[model samples]
Target: MSKEYLDGIIRRSLEIRNKYHELERLHHGSEWTVEEDALAYLTDAGLVGRNIMSQQQRWPKAGSQTELEHKLGENIWWLIVLAKRSGIDIKDAVNNFLTETEAILK
Candidate 1:
């Protein structure tokens, strides 16, 4: 996907996470729903389901596909938060790793 789209997904990831935190505060972490639980731990069924269906002829249900994409962004958001918290710069890391990997391959 395009960087712009990726940025938007990343934005959404943080947004949902912030909402979850708010819910926890409002309910003392006792009033969340099952769906919320899905987002809480990044239990992205869509991604997993896709893998299951990949080898099959038919596609996964549309709704399941949507959930997968949503979860993908949310998971990435979590990664962004963790990296920021740990002062890990993924961009630089990716560049350094790419060079090392390429050298090894060559």
Candidate 2:
């Protein structure tokens, strides 16, 4: 995708995150800590695994594909948010990962 498209996606993701932070501040008197975000991300990551198990018929869940799709997207969002919180440039990080991995594979 074009950088412009990716920027739009990131903008939307951050906007959603801002709303969640606002809600958290109202409920908890503070935004969630980075550790809390990490925990939430891990929870979703576990659900992703569960969905994979269901997809493979190893789990008894009735709906896996849709939830899997959602979790996968949610994971990406979490990564983006985590990177922002940690002062990383997400686009550069992704680019470096892909480039280095592809070079190593080749």
lDDT by residue (1-106, candidate 2, tens digit) is: 9999999888888899999999999999999999999999999999999999999999999979999999999999999899899899999999999999999999
In Å, residue 6's CA in model 2 sits off its true spot by: 0.9
The number of the candidate with the highest lDDT is 2
lDDT of each: 0.61, 0.95
Give the worst 10-residue stretch by lDDT in candidate 1. Answer: 51-60
RMSD each, Å? 5.6, 0.9
- Candidate 2 regions with alpha-carbon error over 4 angstroms: none
In angstroms, the error of model 2 at 31 is 0.4
Across 34-75, the per-residue lDDT of candidate 1 in tens digits comes to 455546545544465564464352674556555656666555
